[model samples]
Target: MPTGLVALLDDVAAIAKVAAASLDDIGVAAARAGTKSAGVVIDDAAVTPQYVTGFHPSRELPMIWKIAKGSFKNKLIFLLPAAVLLGQFAPFLIPIILILGGLFLCYEAAEKVLEWLHVDETTKHDEPAIVEGHGREEEMVSGAIRTDLILSAEIMAIALSEITDEVWWQQGIILAVIGIVITVGVYGAVALIVKMDDVGLHLATENEGVVAAFGRGLVAFMPKLLTTLSIVGTLAMAWVGGGLLVHNIAAVGWHGPEHLIEIISHPLLGLFPESAEMTVGGIAFALLSGILGVLVGAGIAPLVHRFFPHGAEANE
Candidate 1:
């Protein structure tokens, strides 16, 4: 080969190797960040299906798609650059933002709890009211996306924290990868969950034997499952919110709440076998955090209703 051609091929190979290494780095960072954010991811998944609860079956996937697209816009378009900038220039602000987001989650959870208890007459009822019209659908999708923005902020923050040492461009690439992967994973699961009854119905009608039986079972089970998910989602909001508050509070120099949670949850570890102690302890801590969330939320709820009475009334 000509010397010039050989040099060109060597340069091309070196560039390919560099690109491959960058991809590998991103993959590893994304995985670590995603794993760290799994709890929030699960909460996001759990919280989403509730938005589509009263919509028609045909609208379920479409609504989820809308929300998913909005989620992408949140994490990628808006949050990705913001995270990069903040991570580089304003690291101190991140925890404060998380704390505020936690409060919002707590407030939302508390409002739902108050509504469930009949103490709040301004909020929507527990029974899924068939909300009609494009306007209502848009409202619901927007709300879901707004909630997603908070959760995605946390996810991106977590991911960004993991990759803070990387170059700015690399951090952005990894964060983008994490954002896309998580949005797809979360909404894909939501789509399946929301449309499960439709799949069940199809199988129940078109198949027979065990397949039909299972389909019938699914058809019957989805409503209860959705209800369970609603309840779980609410609790998840509380726990995630509370967890954020406690941890971030500690991050900001107030270790009192964090210590309190440890004090409350530490004893529970003894209730389980040694092998299960970590799992039990973690659950205990989460439940404790959730209790704190409930308390904080309850405190804020009355104030919110008093100040934003029209906001509640609008929902009604």
Candidate 2:
């Protein structure tokens, strides 16, 4: 009986080892693949702040909670299945969809710029109307979900492209990981950001010297921080959105932009030293892509707003 038990233990140990290895593989692949979606992920985090900016202090946390839940639904429930289906049924369609998403991002960013400068001569739309009444919460929640769908779709597509070596199950799991990780990270940061002022006020009133000083500083800094974040988010949206469209355009058979980038790189390569040259090329192309993307976005914004006022122009 003792000998038999020892053998069984050894067998269990071997199986456990295999299971652990498989899990490690999944973790590594997920991390690698998710990192590729960095651009969209940055844009997502940046854009999310605008959604939570206008609510009352008491309602802010609840509002963020509502949007965060909606974001999860967008990613896991809707996008995960759709991403798998796209990987299976119409692999070719993915690029097309991503390109369109990229365009939308660009348009949204450009519109934000236009609004900030008050160039369009429209009323203040940087903030959406607050829904009130019995149905108001539901309306706000639904609107958040609708907004999240667009952002989540962009995130998933970028993540999907990131998973180069995975089969369907592998890709699906990586995307799920990315979605959950990013959603939690974004909302968690947002919650902390929104509440800082309150936290600061409480601290400032406290008897403790250090805490009070920090609180005072936070109260002074909150507005500046939010303003900076808004600026960064808009710029990120333009650059990422433009980058996605340009890359996808090449993938879908337009060699013009890609070729032009290469040609531009060659000149920089001759002008710069070895290691720095590569970085120069990349930065230049990214700038080129961003500038072109803004132009493209500006051009398409009017048509899009006319046809689908809620498209990228949801403004909320």
Candidate 3:
């Protein structure tokens, strides 16, 4: 081969290798970021199906699709640039933003808890009801998206924190990947979860023998599963919200809550073998944070309802 031709081919090969390495780096970073946000991801999946609970079976998927689209918009359109810009220009504000989002989560969770306990009948009846159809669906979808905005912010913030060592553009790319992949993964799982009963019903009708029995079992289990998911979702909101507050509060220089959590969790950590201590300590801290979140929620809910009655009603 001619020398010039050989040199050109070598240069192209080197560029290709560089591109491949960059892609690999992005993949590894995105996965790492996604894993760090798994707790919030679980909370998101747990919380979402409840929104579709009272809707007709056929509307479930469509509603979920709408919410999923909104989730995409929340992460990509709104948050991705904001994360990159904020991380670059205003890193100090990230914690504060998380604190505010945490408060919103706590407030919502507290309201739900009150409703569950039948202690908030006045707020319940005061909520505006639209005639069933597009209006109600829009209301539910918007509410889900609003809740999702906070969760998505947490996810992106977590992901961005993981990738801060990368160059700015690389951080943006990794966040975009994490945003798309996690959103798809979360909402896809939710679709499967919400539609499992329908799947079971079809299986029960279309199959026979052991398959039919299993289908019947699935059908029987689904309602209970959904109910369990609702409860779990509520707890998850409190846990995640409170954890955010505890960690961010400490980040912003108030170590009191963090110290209290560590003190409380110390004995719990001691009960475990050394190998399991980290996991036990984490769980202990999470439980403590969740309790804090519940208290914060309870404290804020009444004030929010009193000062922002219409706003609170709209959330319901």
Candidate 4:
């Protein structure tokens, strides 16, 4: 009996060790996947604030909560399963889907640019009015969720692509963890950002000295910050999307865009010290990719608009 009990304890200990190692693997994989999707995460963090702008301060958090819930649904209920099944059953389709998603991102970014330049007629109308009346909140939440779905799909796909050697269930778990972490991080940041002005106002009016000055600074800086984030988000979407297309094409033996990046980056390589060379090259590559993405998007926009005017804005 004593020997048998010892054997059972040893078996339990072994099981515990295996469980721990599996968890560690999942953590490392999740981090890698999350980092791979960072560009989209930034774009998401930047995109969400626009939804809350001009709303009543009281409604801001609630609206964000609603959006967060929708985002969770988008990732966990819809995207996660789809991504897992795609990887399991039809791996060849992965590249095609990624390319299509990248093109969609490019198209969305280009459409925004057109609107900014007044070349798109949709920019002329006022954004849907912010009202406390019935259905207004639902309209805003629904719109935000629709946009989140694409971004969430991209995030999950990017995450899924990075995970190798894991079983389908393991990959799904890693993706699920990633989805949850990103949604929390993005929405939490958005909540803090949209309310900073209110915080600043309170500090400015209710306090004094450095606190007041800081508050004043926060209030003044937010608009410029939002504007900058908007531009960055657009550029990031283009760069990431363009890079995806370029790399995937290279994977299949066409290397034009890849070679162009190396060519563009090569000259500057010698300009920087060895340590900074990689950084410089990366920037050069990203810049070229972004430019290409914008051009591709712009070229496609007219065709998309002619046939699918309504779909264009939704994709954007």
Best by TM-score: 4
Per-residue CA lDDT of model 2 for 187-227, tens digit only, reads 89888888999899989997478878999999999889878
Each prediction's whole-model lDDT (CA) = 0.84, 0.78, 0.85, 0.86
Predictions: Cα RMSD each: 3.6, 3.0, 3.4, 2.3
Compared to the true structure, candidate 4 yields what TM-score? 0.91
Candidates 2 and 4 compared: the better one by lDDT is 4
TM-score on alpha carbons, each prediction: 0.81, 0.86, 0.83, 0.91
Task: Give the worst 10-residue stretch by lDDT in candidate 2.
Answer: 122-131
Give lDDT tens digits, candidate 1, residues 95-166: 788788788778777777777898876676477887788998999899888878878987887677678788
Candidate 1 residue 157 Cα shift, in angstroms, is 3.1
Q: Candidate 4 clashing pairs?
A: none
Poorest stretch of ten by lDDT in candidate 3: 122-131
Q: In model 4, what is the error at residue 168, expressed in angstroms?
A: 1.0
Cα error, candidate 1, residue 274 (Å): 7.4
